[model samples]
Target: MENKQKKIVLTGGGSAGHVTPNLALVPELLQHGIDVHYIGTDDGIEKTLVHDIPFHAISAGKMRRYASVKNITDIFKIFKGTKESKRILKGLKPDLVFAKGGFVSVPVVWAASKLKIPVILHESDYTPGLANRLCIKKAQKICLSFDTADARSERSILTGSPIRKDILDGDRAAGLASLSFSGDKPVLLIMGGSLGAQAINDAVDAALDTLTQRYDIVHLRGKGKLNPGLEGSDSYRQYEYMEDGLPDVFAAADIALSRSGANAIFEFLALKLPALLVPLPLSASRGDQILNAGYFEKRGYAHVLEQENLNALALVQALDALWEQKDEMVSVMGNSKEADGTSNVLNVIFENIGVQ
Candidate 1:
């Protein structure tokens, strides 16, 4: 066989969550001698995340849950994106398409199906997202993070969420040093998703005086969410985002306090790091995070604090409880079958593409 046996296109992104899993699969694809191409929206986060690859930009239409004037206009954009995707896929003639679901991926998958290119979709959430729901019939196989009895379908493969290889290489000391932390106290990592969770930020800020005494805080406050007033606190550090050093932070953290997005929580689980999860309420999202957190909680990997009951006091208390059970939680996570889905997802990809 030649060094490169097949070519494939990876599509997904509207948020960091969608792109990271696809990125996780890149190294293995390259190692297997398969060519990789990426298709994403011109300005979506995927373009930035997939910079090193051969990237194709297409228009993406975000379908919102609620009624909006923009939703009507987005229809035209979706058609344009679909057309652009078809043209790109035809020219590339990739053997397969591996899509991590997002608004951007729906068009790409549809285009792939129309062109008779096999498509595999990886769903990170327990339940399918809107984009995945739309493209399910078009996909040749659906990969699931949650492999429960109810989530099973004939076309579904039980692949846990793919975790980036870099995320597991974090050095605890390097992580502490990066944050200027003394390494004396437990490091608590807080992530509020990519868009920032105002409620989590406000609660953490309110509980800082108490929280800092026992833990060194490194807060990923999301874009433009940093509080200037908390700048000088010795035990606290805030960054808009961390990409290069995120693994180190993950390594340094003994316990994490975060919103239960599937990708973030799975990252924590993969590292065997115990977490206290605060899920987005139903009103905010489709309650996917709530289900993601509940799954972890049921498995003893994390603790869940619903948004409705979240506040400064509850945040501090829940974290304390998590700390008390950290060792047990870590033990459970160490043995969890769903810790990382990278390998399983790769197996399905290569199988579909007939590369291996």
Candidate 2:
């Protein structure tokens, strides 16, 4: 008799950070003969990004840290989402549910717990996000990207962020050809997440001449943030974003300037890409990026530049210093034990699902 094919439901959204890790697992899961389904908010970024898989959309409510009138309405929305998610889970009857922390996952996690389905929650920061904090009690296992993260329950396991395997197979020649550049100088890649960083964007543009003189610049300037006037510069290239071509870009880059998001930084570490991290300030975030940057900086894998101190001159100076120490940074990253967590995370999934 043929064995039944195991199925898994992945739920997470709100931002790219919450979705990418789930995506990194899809191909691997499919290869292992596991059927994959994803649950996300109808209007969330996950809906757009998880097109390759079977996607179910449910209404999700944001759990804001601060009080507001929407809180009352959102409570109803949360209840509604939970009800919808429960129905979906009942019909799918998946063997396991894996959630990456995001507001959208809260409803799905609650539904899974109520139905007595095994669920694993992955947190990608030094501290648990509000969503994961609420879902911890219900999760059978919690996977953490940072070892220092507070695990309220003994079920938590420190598994570094999962990085997509394809990202590591980039071709340097193809990457340079994509930008129509000759390998005359070192390439510096600047990225500020998917939405782009306004401060970093402005500083990069302002310091273009200074930067271009020392390195070939490849900047992912965020959507709608490109300067049309700077289009034809020989040593600089600007892109809003690249999906399939990103790996090649990584292959082409010698160093990187980026925001210190856990998923992105971990990928950089896995790739051994020397970076100068500029974390979002406390005014903009909950200081997770600052903590992420500080951890890497202390480990000698990257350098940190506080967002508040960022400017054209400061950016230029930091890059220069980062370049000087690039070899050492790469060495530390190569030696780091927490580089990739794809296999560790997969082990958790298989263990919980009773798949040997």
Candidate 3:
């Protein structure tokens, strides 16, 4: 008799930072004849992002950095989401659960553990998120993007972050066309991750006119509504989402104004694109971005700007400095190509699943 095909459940969402890597993992697992199921909340970008995939809907609620009256609502959501997760896991009976870090992952990880199903978590930050932190003790393995993550868990492995295969394999020409950029001028790619960063968007808005005059810009605005000024810039183009064709944007970019999310940071490294990072403020409960930014700043691979001190002029000045150092920055970033994270992570997962 043949054994049943093993099922692997991936729990994550709330932002592209968490879901993008898991999305990159899906095709690889599927090719091996393993079944993949996603567990995430409907409220986040996941609803639209994971549309065609087999996903179990559950509500994990929000994790806020500061105390909010809304925190009361989140408390109840955690309990409810946990119950939903247990029900879903019971039906799927997956051999393992991969919980990508976020508040939405909390319920699923909790449920998977309670059911005695082994769980693996991927932490994309140098500093772990609340959900991954909660699961660190319980997870059978923790795959991390940074070496520092090992401090958070005894079982953690520094696998870097999983990047999409296309991204890892993409070339300069592939990215340029995919991003709809002509090769005539320098391109500046702007992104604040999936949900967008109002602060970063605001700074971009402040500098748009000046920026567009010099460079053709690809602004991935995410879900944030556009600033009127950006909408009107002759040299600026906005995308609510990139839809799996990010390489062109990356390829077209001579410099990037970006948030320091682990996925983007690693992808930028893979592309060898110089970046000016504006770490999201602590108010967003993302100390991870700060650590990520610091790593590059310490290495001269990128520039860092804290949100509190940011303004249009300062942003312009920073861009000027990074642009002037383009060759040096690119050289520093070139070394980052050594990190092909997806393959490393997949190897670990395959090993865990006994698929050598």
Candidate 4:
């Protein structure tokens, strides 16, 4: 008799970063004939981001750093989410659970552990997030993006972050044409991330005149952050967010100014895009981006401009410095052994599932 088709469930959500790596793995998984499904909250960004697969929605309690009234109620929600996960997993009977850390992944990973199903967790930061930290003991293996001291355990594998194939297939001409750019000057891609960076947006507002003198700018100002005053500028274009043309934008960019999220920086490395990183301040985040930027900066893969020193003048000066070192940064990126981890992650998944 023929064996049943191998099945897998990917779990992650809360932000675009959490869902992106899982998306990168989908094409390859389908090509290999592995059945793929997704588990996330019913209303998360993940639900809208994921398509063409059996997506099972489950309750997920958000992870928080501070005590709040929601924390008390979320305990019950988490318990309910675990129950929902167990029911879904039993029905799917997946051979493995592959997860990129996010709040939604915690309940699912916990449920998978309880079911005696093997789980593989991918940590896309210099330091593990709380979700991954809680699931570490339950996970069979932990995949890492950085070769940090804390991730030196036997079960940890430094396979790097998986990058979407389309992100690496950007066409400069297409990007320029789509934006109505003349390509007379280098393109500057400024991304403040999905929710938008007010500081970045404000800095650009102050520096636009100076910046546009030498570079055409593409600004992904996050949702609801677009400035109508700057809409008429010929050398500048702004979008709330992009999907269809994002690869082209990346392709056309001469230098990237972005938040140093693990997913972002790794993709930049893969494309050999020179970057000027502005990590989220520690007061606003867990300091993961700071460490992530530090790692790349130390290796000459990118330059870091701290959020504390961020201003219109500082932004311009730092970008000028990044432009000066751009060629060297590209050379360093080309020589670096770190790369997209799609194949490595797939190999690990197959190895654990007792398949090729």
Candidate 5:
């Protein structure tokens, strides 16, 4: 008798960080002949990023850490979303579900639990987010991107974050050509993530002349954050974002200055890119990025610059220090354990699905 085809339902959204891991799994799952599907909020980033895959959008409510006027209405939204998710799960009858941590994943995990569909949740932070904490009991396996994560459950497994394969194979020549850089100087890539960082942008922009004198700068300023005035500056290029060209840009970079988001930093580690990380301060975030940065610094993988103390002068000093130590940083990254979790994660999924 022939074996039945395996089907998987992946759920995560709100930010690109929550969705990219699922995207990393898609190509591998397809190669294994497994049918892949995504469940996300209708308006979330996941819906936009998970193109070419069969995506199912269901209503989801944000689980706020602070009190908000919408909390009352969001309670009803969660209940409604759970109902919708359950209905969708019943129709799809998938063999398993994989959830990356995000508010949009809560309803899908709950529905999968009630239906007895096995779930594997991936937590990318040192601490579990509110969404993942709620879904912990429902998940059959909890894959962690950070070993420091306090899942405490026997199901938790430390599997570093999954990274796209193409990112590791970027073409330096192509990257230089794409940016119209002469390759006369080292490239310093600045990325503030998909939403951009106003503080970093301001500081970098203010110190552009100083930075441009030392290196060619490729700045991903996030969506709508490009400065029109800097368009024709020598040894400087600014882009809102890059989809297909991101790999090439990475290849061309000698060093990086970035926000310390877990997924992004892990990709830097995997690619052996020496970076100076400026974590979002505790006032703005849950301090997860601070912890992530600290971890990398402790491991000698990257240098950290606190956002509160960062200015144009401080940014230049930090980048200069990082550049001076770039060789050591690259060596440390190379000596560390492999950072790509794609295969390890896929093995877990296959084990749970009874595939060898």
Candidate 6:
């Protein structure tokens, strides 16, 4: 709308599970000559992921689903976060605010709404979180990761989730080198969401000797401590994160063991990698994982194992079942629908922002 590059603000964090997807949109917006600013809390994962980006820090206090005395303190924190967000908006005067909903995004979205700035939100979960639900009315558009989440909002459109462009374009040879493994054996990729699944990690820890016997393993340790329990064993590698290069890891893998987060789930499908899913328990407040895992299970694209029922034995058994039916699994993976979500999403944002 002006000669200067349009300033845009993005807010979301509190966990890598949310932040990583938000980060994926940065380069795209930058390529379009837009200046991006972030608003997030100091207390959450935003600090680690968006640390390099220009950001306004806010005190978005903790919000617990269950009743707690701490709620009183957090309410005050949320209000403080809103004030900080208002100041940032007033100073930046962004053309739009793109929010990936979480505790951190609440303030920025609220401020943008009050200031009458166009706001767009993305929900990576099938069941939207409370912060996102609150922003629904004020949000000019809602980008969703799955079809199931559509019922919650009239403005919702399925955009999958933004992932690194290279990941969406990976080749097999690049995939093999990415994990530092030879192309001889079938590669297996394991990820326990963003923070790492300690329970899944423990189960993998217990079955390492058994698993490496058949598959080359690339275990993403998430935020969990890395002990290198499988170092002495051949064909096993572990890391606390995968920011450096991950398309290679996914491209090399014949199968993957992953927690059911929207980013991971859709990326796996985009890569057409068969998977065994472990949904974070219902008590986790985001019942979306269950819905996500179930949707794939219904389509035979992946398998789901609830946390309570997951153990080393069960995990191995599921692995074996998948291996035994490799042909069927591959066929299912091959049939997966192609997802060209980012371009579609950008169109929606452009139309609303009055971009030519």
The parts of candidate 2 lying over 4 Å away from their true place are 149-153
What ranges in model 6 sit over 4 Å off? 1-4, 51-53, 149-153, 169-171, 174-180, 222-229, 324-338
Per-residue lDDT tens digits for candidate 2, residues 1-356, read 99999999999999989998999999989988899999999899999889678999898898787989888899899999999999999999999999998999999999999999999999988888999998999998999887673543489887889888999999999999998879899999999998899999999989999999999999998899888989888999998988878899999999999999998899998899999999999999999999889988998989999988999999999999999999988988887767878878998899888777
Could you tell me every candidate's TM-score relative to the true structure?
0.94, 0.96, 0.85, 0.96, 0.95, 0.88
Query: What is residue 239's positional error in candidate 4, in angstroms?
Result: 1.5
Task: Tally clashes: model 3.
Answer: 2
Worst 10 residues of 2 by lDDT: 145-154
Which segments of model 3 are wrong by more than 4 Å? 1-3, 59-77, 149-154, 168-182, 205-213, 222-235, 239-241, 283-286
Write candidate 5's Cα lDDT for 109-154 as tens digits.
Answer: 9999999999999988877889999999999899987766354458
Q: How do the residues 196-266 of candidate 1 rate in per-residue lDDT, one tens digit apiece?
A: 78989999999999999989999999899989999998999998888678899999999998999999888
RMSD of each: 1.8, 1.6, 3.2, 1.4, 1.6, 2.8
lDDT of 4 by residue, 1-356 (tens): 99889999999998988999999999988887899999999889999999988999999887578989898888888889999999999999999999898889999999999999999999999998998998999989999989787567889988889889989998999999999999999999999877888988898899999999989999999999999989788899999999788999899999999999988899999999999999999999989999999999998999999888999999999999999999999999887766757777878888998877
Model 6 alpha-carbon miss at residue 80, Å: 2.2
Which one wins by TM-score: 5 or 6?
5
All models: lDDT?
Answer: 0.90, 0.91, 0.81, 0.91, 0.90, 0.80
Q: What is the lDDT of candidate 3?
A: 0.81
Poorly placed runs, candidate 4 (over 4 Å): none
Q: What's the best-to-worst order under TM-score?
A: 4, 2, 5, 1, 6, 3
Q: Per-residue lDDT for 41 in model 3?
A: 82
